[model samples]
Target: MKPDIHPVSRPVVFRDRAAGVAFLTRSTAHSTRTIEWEDGAVHPLVDVEISSASHPFHTGTSRVLDTAGRVERFERRYGRTAPNRR
Candidate 1:
């Protein structure tokens, strides 16, 4: 281990505004904003647009694309041709 070589990690508050959820975790990320946590401590606040709480995949709301159907449509539009041999 080296001395004073690692970036400082401190408690940071990641706020997911879309999900209205805030959690405290240690990170090297910095923010100009501050937030008062549930423990009555102030931590650097980072606003995130999406998180596991609000993400489509995490929330089980993501759509499964019909790749086979898309391939069929593309073949219909542009007739499927035989592979060219060298």
Candidate 2:
């Protein structure tokens, strides 16, 4: 463990603009903006478009696509049948 090799991990607030969610975590990332946290402490704030709260996958709003089913349906309609493995 060298003194100069380690990066600082301080509390940073990542705010999701659309979802209105704020995350408090330690990161090396720094910003000029600051905000008062829920605990009455000020921390560096980073504005983000999407976060775990707003992201489709994390929020369970992601669209599930059936690739195999869609391909079969397309082949049947377009009349381009693939070779049967059987």
The digit string of per-residue lDDT tens for model 1 on 1-86 reads 98999999999999999999988999999899998999899999999999999999999999999999999999999999899999
Q: After superposition, how far is residue 30 of candidate 1 from its true place, in Å?
A: 0.8
On lDDT, the candidate that comes out on top is: 1
- Candidate 1 local lDDT, residue 15: 95
Highest TM-score among the candidates is held by which one?
1
| TM-score of each predicted structure versus truth | 0.84, 0.81
1-86, model 2: which lDDT tens digit per residue? 76888888999999999899899999999899999999999999999999989999999999989999999998889989568997
List where candidate 1 sits over 4 angstroms from the true fold.
none
For candidate 1, what is the lDDT? Answer: 0.96
Off by over 4 Å in 2: 81-86
lDDT of each: 0.96, 0.93
Worst 10 residues of 1 by lDDT: 35-44
Estimate the overall C-alpha local distance difference test score of candidate 2.
Answer: 0.93
Question: Which residue pairs does candidate 1 place in steric collision?
Answer: none
Worst 10 residues of 2 by lDDT: 74-83
